[model samples]
Target chain A: MDRAVFFISDHTGITAEALGRSLLSQFPDFRFERTTLPFVDTEVKLRAACQRIQASQRDSGQAPLVFSSLANAGLRTLLMASGAVVFDVFEGHIERLETALGLQSAQAVGRAHGFHAQGRERIEALKFALDTDDGLRADAYGAADIILVGVSRSGKTPACLYLSLQYGVAAANYPLAEEELERVELPRTLRAWRDKLFGLTLAPERLHLLREERRPGSRYAALPQCRREIQAAAALFQTAGIPCLDTSNMSVEEIATTVLHRSALKRLRW
Target chain B: MDRAVFFISDHTGITAEALGRSLLSQFPDFRFERTTLPFVDTEVKLRAACQRIQASQRDSGQAPLVFSSLANAGLRTLLMASGAVVFDVFEGHIERLETALGLQSAQAVGRAHGFHAQGRERIEALKFALDTDDGLRADAYGAADIILVGVSRSGKTPACLYLSLQYGVAAANYPLAEEELERVELPRTLRAWRDKLFGLTLAPERLHLLREERRPGSRYAALPQCRREIQAAAALFQTAGIPCLDTSNMSVEEIATTVLHRSALKRLRW
Candidate 1:
């Protein structure tokens, strides 16, 4: 039978979904329908969530699996007995933590991604990332926490976006165009931000494939062109002593983490 | 003393961090030093993780809080016995799930956000989001799963971006410039894709505040101008019979969720 998986949370259900997916991924053979019930911070909403779970169980003729990060003890206890297989994503751990540390968890609600408390800062950071994306607004460099420099399709854009969305870092990326690639020195605009400059590089084969997807059979997509550009970019970054990361096999999360770690750039600690 | 909190995972530790932070945020009075350790897929890595936890305990002279989403049972057992306050982010749930479902989880590793299996698709979607942002490439609308429309700073860009990054949705956003807002009708390019079009509106005060940050005291940032633009934009959206969402007082996650639900757009389904 196809199973139902619910990710329920008092705030943004991102955490419940993430942890639940990691576990459910292990059981890939089973067919599953996933639902997210976020901001279930009220008793009324919790009742509706329970009704949905009970309905899923009735419709599927099997117990539905629930992964919850609900912080309210009363709601959690209510959810646990809601006729579904409940997975308290945080309760057991919180209890253990409370005991080991001789402290009690405050069980606060909706602070993870509330955004309202610090919405202006995060919104500005996100705007900064979008406005300065792909070197669109070079004049704004003075406000950037760090600037990512790379050849086209070296994974600069997504890395910047991830850093902004996940860490509230004001990241801007500058593409090393053909002229800059052929030059040994860093671009004129980047020289002023030398300390804040970071580079992203990738394998020639990967670059060729990524470019080919956009412009099939073009000179830009040729393996030789990719190789020469990467070599030039690498040399330029090396001579300039700019920190670089190879994003050929790394996910955006990994690239962002590595860049932040290597540069020690300050994140707007959300 | 500041408490140490570690978000441990077999993959990108993002899940552990998100949920852990949500739970920990409740205890606002306590100071915390957060650390994320991803890709703990081996015994060696687990041992090193234990060492880190042990050292934290020793340095702080207090039990360190660990939130883990590691899927391997053997490794989880080893981690539980580590010298920290262990929070099994997934185990108790997984065990109960197995018993209730009458099936065994595959215990596979690195499946949540494992870009290796689907990186190309996600990268393409992200690139699409960037290229089509702010109506840059209008011709590419045919390729988009959904198009977001609203005046500048109406929360369209970030919502589009979040949809792309999190769910691999090919979301394109267009600004309702003065010309379009004054016309009282959807733009020519958008009229063709009416079914794919979604609208984002925000409170005039919020828009004024957001725009003022970028360009202080300009017409674009004036409260009166914002009020007029938003009124015209909302009227246009309403007259055109297009569905719209108000982004005021809502997080980007909430806006994205509401948009996806209202439009029933197909998510890339990662």
Candidate 2:
């Protein structure tokens, strides 16, 4: 079944989107497309998302499933007629909490539970890696919950580490070597668990700018090298059917969330 | 001088507020208060905050030192007349980054650095502890840059561990014992490092709920005992002159940020 998710949140879109990703991480192999509309109180934003979902169905020529985690109840009627399966986290969690607590869920108190599922393990793992100074924490193929493969200075290491620090994901990043790029093949270890492998590539100019920070005058930071490696990496990723994201202008939050949301193995724990 | 810190940010206020607490940790003798205004956009919210600062000054009969890290340029004019010393992180790091890069300040890109700088030793200690599974990370008292102490569920342990992981700060935490609470005095090891020791306390009810999750039908989770221990802990903290936070309502992000913001010894570095 085709599936698409939409988040209509009261605050910023980040909360709903983050919640969606964590939940998807629990349910792997669900072909899902998801998007979020912030400040959904307005009809215009709501209608645009609805139209976009409709367009996706039209383009694919397949009936799609829709799940909404909305802060607003007003959209319930509006979305019911959209001909997509709808599962709402807001209601699901609220019902569960109320059942357990044997009382009505207060908005403030309930919101607290949303943040309770701690990334404690993830945070601890990061500490273990950083504390030991054992460079293995940096190796992507072995320890990472998600391995980020990309050309040098494509924001692989920091982004993966940030994911580890912030979310408790054991994010190990492997840089694409020139030899690997020449072969246009994924890393040997990466090929074993192709499902967990994700690629991050950026614009050649951006790569040069980021690299110039570490080594100012070197062929390693040259634009030609960046362009070549990125092109080769993209080709390998496409060949392996591993999803790749172009993180050229995206913020760290955007890049991490996009990868989490679009990944085939995302299971929703939040 | 009496000091109180306020964090204003375009991002989540929880993060700014956490960072503020971290900065405060640096000056152990400073009597400081802290608060945050997250997702602040309206004129009324700003005005209310200014009034609160004024009221605080009037009550204390002293000019309050205020640390504000505002992301928005709009608040500058409004706060110019306030009777508090405001340090803005948004503007503070620009020159540092430029000097490091040996580039003209104007030519330096603003959003470049995001990594931990201090406490590498502690991270290593924690890593060594976790790998050996010896729980010796607990015994890393002398090596710790800072030590955390509180009751079982007061968030001391995780916070210290987070510091160890993120910045490699040697962090040791000791849970207060029943006898220690009865004595209503700082534990021996904590008293020895009075200047470096920080305390964490949470609302009794919240502590009870948290304890109940880990263990149900235990004396620790009982409301009466929870209240008693928390009160005793607070009294001990007051006598020791160690600043403590009531972490019941706050998220982990909030707690960690406040610790970092207050810790004078650390700063954001790559």
Q: Best-fitting candidate, measured by lDDT?
A: 1
Candidate 1 error regions (>4 Å): A97-116, A136-142, A183-185, A191-195, A235-243, A262-267, B41-51, B100-116
For each candidate in turn, the interface RMSD (Å) is: 2.9, 18.4
For residue B220, model 1's alpha carbon misses the true position, in angstroms, by: 2.8
lDDT, candidate 1, A213-267, per-residue tens? 8899999999999999999999999999999999888877778877876787654
DockQ of 2: 0.02
Best by DockQ: 1
Best by TM-score: 1
Candidate 1's TM-score: 0.88
Cα shift from native, residue B168, model 1 (Å): 1.4
Clash pairs (backbone) in predicted model 1? none
TM-scores of all predicted structures:
0.88, 0.39
